[model samples]
Target: MKLEMLDTSIFIAYVVGLLIIALWISRNEKAEGRNTEDYFLASKSLPWWAIGASLIASNISAEQIIGMSGSGYALGLAIASYEWMAAITLIIVGKYLLPIFLKNGIFTMPQYLEQRFDSRVKTTLALFWIAVYIFVNLTAVLWLGGLAIQTVAGVDWMFGMIFLAVFSIAYSLYGGLKAVAYTDILQVVLLVFGGLLLSYLALVEVSDGQGFIAGFSVLTHELPGHFDMILSPDNENYMNLPGISVLVGGLWVMNISYWGFNQYIIQRALAAKDLKEAQKGIAFAAYLKLLMPVIVVLPGIAAVILYPQLTSPDQAYPSMMELMPVGIKGLVFAALVAAIVSSLASMTNSISTIFTMDIYRPLQPNKSQNHYVHIGRIATLVALGLALITAQPLLGQFDQAFQYIQEFTGVFTPGITVIFLMGMFWKRTTSQGALSAAIGSAIFSFALKFTFPDLPFMDRIGLVFLLCLALTVVVSILTASKEGDESSNQSVSLDEVSFATDRGFNLAAIGCVIILTFFYVTWW
Candidate 1:
């Protein structure tokens, strides 16, 4: 399904224009002299809209576009629980978590950990995140993105991967977070437009040009099983979604770990102009999450009917793109590229941040801010290089990269979630306890995996989270009693930090919930 000349021209124009915008945004940073704060946090000036756009841009990359669409082809709409559930999770994070982070003025998650616990915990998790971002996250994004281009435009996969990596670094390397966040607005718009366009075309084809609504009706009427919001135990895809547990169990812990504590995702909110704007951005992202399934998932479901002979589920999205006309195909292809590179930029930026702020800066305390910023840039390059080298080797075997990523990350999310949840709300939690939970998370998850092979991964994560939470509490109590320091070791003053939101935010949250309820109820 090679793209036509017009399509190629449109995609090239988009790429060139995006690079210009990014370079322009970052043009003044070097002249003004770079600093860690300016480069890493965008000088703390992101408004709600940029922050919101960047959040979605950074999140819905190759995994959501290609991988989850593959899951949609295989697992049905049950896969959409990840996006739909994340809408509610974003609200919870905005209301409960962003306030604390804003009040603390922390640059990185590890820095927050250091404030609440100690350097040991900060360094440990910082190292862990760097490794995961480079190996698991960065590689997966690059691999799936390269695969997307190969499938859609008949481009060489290696060429596509290198182009994405180079393009991301070219736009983002100098301008830093500012370049990434602002350009992300364009990226999100393109991705949404492209995604919706693809979905609409797919539906129209499904209805034999009867139109989107008619096509949607035909799909729901014909493939009723694909419309199920909650998969029953007997459903083959139940292991991935795990039915009602997606709403009530381990998925919540997963969502909290991702939306709340993840460095790249939360970094956007942390860069907001103020707490109010950050919360607003978060609320804005929640609505976007509600829209994501329509853009990313529907095309895959349509693929089931349109191109049932696809060799792999991941091919669903690209296969659908073949249905687009010339110029539209270019625009949507550019949108897919936008989603991929934005995330690559975002992830690399955070990797640099965690490395520079949490690890390197601490060791070289007397280094100039410029030197730290330089180190951060270097770290970004290094991380991306590692990912490029390892992307294929790491993710080549996975048929559904989205589910593989979820399962791989699920093992560690429980501990990370427990540490953050207990650290923020429970003053009694000690550094040792947090560290124990972090380490025990992997041990418990692996043990459960081998011992109870039949248990759904989602349920396993939920149980492991509870176990980690209990471990943190018990270890905190015992350690405190042994040390004869019963009072809280947490340095942050939570009493002074307010979690209250403006009325607009409250209304937006209610709207998000209402929309999600409508989706689930209608689908269920």
Candidate 2:
């Protein structure tokens, strides 16, 4: 049970690197007139490729790299369903979902919902997403990043928490969307490289005289059913209670909302130079998603083969890092730091946007734009503080770091995804429909969460997702769009974004879907 934790040298180097990067990003954000638009949407100048890479990196974070892989280890092959499903989701977003978004020149997903449905719907989904990303996802994000920092860098968690909060707020608040997007591009590169290094190291450990296959032979003999698609219900394997259905369903619901609808993530794509470039960004991310299992998941599987007696799956990932070859330790540490900072920076920017645009600016319509920008910065700092404090209770609380976060996200995602979808394409969808889906999904998820708390609540995302969809459709059909508002418009243009890059991106996206489908059938 007692093992060498982590080298303090590696941890220290990572923190130092993080500081240098954060300061560098802050400098870039200060370019003249980059104020409002620059801070919010990266001045809408982010090319599709930058937005795409950033989108993937921002979405991956510590949760996907560390936590999700931990789940892959715990659940075996079933957890991989998330990545597989996510690829398809992006395709749908690119083809069916995006035209509506880009066409309206919408700033936030909520804004589009407001115009198509009602302001009340916009506010409701906006508030729900805020709670999920900020209160729930944001807390875990900081905590996990802090945990990684503490393990690799040597700062105590309380201090680590503060360090993450301060650095994340400093630049994200200062740079706005521009900082987050560009930094995301940087983070994605680091994350992918880290994944490659980690996989190579793991493969080397397993290989013997012949190399990879020889090394892989050890796992086959050591961990029976390590590759099992169906895990026992009583066991920790992903197939346990939620089963393959939830695996498929949970992933379907989450990715659709995450890639297609979530504002913070989508905003990156929205800033693309053209539709083609936007598509490229998304396809690039999908390609990366396919590779993640090899990086994040395989390690966990290898950990089980190598360190089977650890007695806890959560220990699997950290155990691998502690045992990695010394020369490569620094790279892993650097990559981990990148993941943490990228996520922290993202959430900080998004929460600040919500506070300023959704709540404050509306309330104070007469305020100078300059004054509003100042207020946005202040709100970012406050959010960082709250997130840090919120993360405090989570410290050392959950045995499995990732699941704790997913369960929380599942509750809010169902409602947010439902309302956003209805409000976007369905003109007949009324405020009443949006309200019901949001309120209904939240109430239903809450009830189920309490009634079956320890169960794989991923089904919770699906349950309310289905319900909200049903309610939205039924309500829209029943009440209809306001008499004069026109409920029957069905053609949303593919060129809604009107940017230069999107068409090429669409071609790339189609190619990605083809590749992903091949994988799905083969994997299936």
Candidate 3:
């Protein structure tokens, strides 16, 4: 793909304008009076709109824009289970998980674990998350962003990584989550608009200049097989998203771990002004998730019809973008860049928050708020620096970056999800049991991967989750305290009222479930 002068100018202007807007909104946060709460949690002052936009922006990145589209080209509509299932997952998290985290006034997921289990559990998971964010999550996003830039603008890969890292760190480091969340509002807008435009144009081209509706009709009628949401056992992509397992099995494990417990994605809701605001924000994000396939997945399907001769599925997104005219091309490119940078900023902020709050502050207690805030900024730089250095090598290991990310993260999700679920609902769960479950789950996941290399990764995750759940239960029962033992009551109490649902939230959640059900039934 070649970029003309006008396209280059517009892209540059869009990036500079974003930096200016983000910095301008965050100026107050960088002032002298800014403290730990203000920096790390945005002073817990974000409203529903900001929270919702930030959640979507943080969640959608090059992985979805590039990697998922690549999957769409290869695997077809079945790949959208990730996005569609996430809509229902967000609702579950809002109704069931957000209340618990909010009631505890926790700043991070590990902090909630600490309250439920012990410091050992908190510190262990906190370090684990820090390592994953820097090495896996952050590195993957940087590498994909660099690859996109290289594909679209013909830029050097290393330079592209440096460029994205610098812009993301610039506004986020000084202002923290405040800047990241607020700027995400604009990022989401650009992402949605640009993504839709790309899809619309791709469809138009595929239909030989006919409108989108006509193109869509042609696509469905001509490529009927590509529309299957449930894959058969003989299908090539069934291992990644197995037939019914996507609805009932390991996909749920992945979604719950990501939407409910992941620090980067959940931190937006944690920053909401109140529980009501947080739930509303989550519902709003669910609605956005419903629209994700239109922008992120459909273009890949269209590319199959429009550019059938292309050799690589990863080239689908860039090949489609190259079809756009000059000014529109720039806007769409800006949107892609927006998706990359917003996600990078969110991850960087979350890593800093986890390290500073969960690890550093606990080890060095009684520090001033300013001291912690300063340390957080420094930690942000270190995390970004490590990601810049390691992204290229780490990304080179996989042919499909999206599946690589999911498969690797799957190893940890089963154990983490089981531990969190038991710790939250079952008062009998002990810290020792939680710790044992965590360690055992990792070993079990690796054993399955190596021992049965041909087993579907999704199926392995399902098996691991069940095994870990049983392990947790047996360990908890054996370690239970005797009658009249005060230590037995030490577990965090689950307040029934915290899990209560209001009418508005209930209606919204029901609506989300209905919509998701309709999509699956219609597409099936």
Give the top-scoring candidate (TM-score): 1
Each prediction's TM-score against the native? 0.98, 0.87, 0.97
Stretches of candidate 3 exceeding 4 Å from the true structure: 482-491
* Model 3 alpha-carbon miss at residue 310, Å: 3.3
- Please list the residue runs of candidate 1 whose C-alpha ends up more than 4 Å from where it truly belongs after superposition: 482-490
Candidate 1: give the clashing pairs: none
lDDT of 3 by residue, 144-248 (tens): 888888989999878999999999988677878888999899899999999999998888887889888999999899877678999888988888888899999
Q: What's model 3's overall lDDT?
A: 0.88
Ranking by lDDT: 1, 3, 2
Best by lDDT: 1
Where in model 2 is the C-alpha error above 4 Å? 1-29, 208-210, 229-248, 447-456, 481-484, 488-524
lDDT values, one for every candidate:
0.92, 0.68, 0.88
Q: List the candidate numbers ranked by TM-score, top first.
A: 1, 3, 2
Of the candidates numbered 1 and 2, which has the greater lDDT value? 1
